[model samples]
Target: MTLASSLLSAISGLRHAFFTREGGVSQGIYESLNAGIGSQDDPVHVAENRRRMAEAMGVAPADFLSLYQIHSPDAVIADRPWDTATRPRADAIVTRTPGLAIGVTAADCGPVLFADPRARVIGAAHAGWKGALTGVLEKTLDAMETLGSKRPDIAVAIGPLIRQRSYEVGAEFVTRFTETNPSYAGFFVPSERDGHAMFDLGGFIRMRLEHAGVETIDDTGIDTYSDERFFSYRRSVHRKEPDFGRHVHALVLEAD
Candidate 1:
């Protein structure tokens, strides 16, 4: 079987993918391509999987970048070549150099890719709920801008997150958003479970991007928690599984 991923027509200087699990060599619960190196999967397997990903992106494994994502608003700017594992702590990374990829491993959270073609800058972010509410996306955009990126010139995309139909959260979640803007409650759909509601995560991201002045945006309509092609922390917990996998969503610039 073939691996799953999406192609972006708008990302001109880069080759990007919201990669899925079908094309790796891992097995059992981790099962074929668990790209989350820090996951419970064997280190060698994760290494091989990431190498395959580099080949797919037309870059060496050293060109790939990821973060020690903690769902915070922090951003890291990479000014030079660095190994993927050694990249610093932050949910987002931006670089003005080409051949450098920005990536984030995710299950249900959003893996967001950004590129500013004119400025030769690229960025990637992992914006889970906490990161989103805390302005992770904005931080990434700001870092990219500092490296000479423009909000209007940046093409933004989000991949393989839990969709609203699959995301049910507690009422406190709604209260938190609504406390910021009374109308923010529109993103929630009341759930069958008491005091819980289905939240529109992708919608919230889009809403914020629009607010942040991003004119071009695309969303990869994959739900990690609901689909077996991807991984989901919540789904694993609900299924009582020992562990889950994280798919890598990456964006890499092609050096001129």
Candidate 2:
């Protein structure tokens, strides 16, 4: 329910939401507001949850769309809604089409929503460590440019994800980032555990967007790992739960 000043100021006409795991019918591990179509939650419950999300965005249920999300750098353009069963395998989606809400699913991973109201273009990306390191955010901006969006005009909001203090990683994970660019090394800090580091996922993402020339970037700064309102895969793993829920971050370009 949080709003980014940049996004709201720049794209006053767009409808967007960074949903938490708090208002759906799924029970137990999937407990409430689990919008992930790929999750093991009941199909009926998932459908109803998605319906609520779409309704909140002021779009029809059929117009709310999300991808299969393989955590790769791949990005696709969505001009129309696709059946859930056949959703494309991609980590990002960009669209200039109105009345269609484009979204990405995430638990601990970064869910970023983008918009350039001047160009009437909007984009959503699922940025896990793999996707972020591999350039999913940059690719999303490039795709928006292709749709006539100026980089400076774009306002991006990085939704809730695991914050640095809660995101511990192995030494190899630190090496993977440093190996790409030594400058990325700064994003990691020493953890309590030996040979481990805590990476600032949100900070790294903000740098990427800034380097790509996006002038307005808003980070929700909510840590999914600690926030009970949001679902987190790492939290679920640590708790030894069977499955975790997923949150949906969506952006819709309303019809004129």
Evaluate model 2: give its TM-score: 0.97
Which regions of candidate 2 deviate over 4 angstroms? 1-6
Q: Give the per-residue lDDT digits (tens) of candidate 2, residues 1-256.
A: 3334455545667888888887789999998989877778998999999999999889999899999999999999999889888999999999999999999999999999999978999999999999999999999999999999999998899999999999999999999999999999999999999999999999999999999999988888899999898999999999998888998889898898
Model 1, 1-256: lDDT tens digits are: 1232333555566778888887898988788888887788998999999888888888888877788788899999986667655768889988887887778888899988888888888888888888998899999999998998999998888787999889989878889999988988888988999999998889888888889989988887778887888878999899898888888888777888
Q: In model 2, how large is the Cα lDDT of residue 171?
A: 95
Model 1 gets an lDDT of: 0.83
TM of each candidate vs. truth: 0.94, 0.97
Residue 184, model 2: lDDT of 98
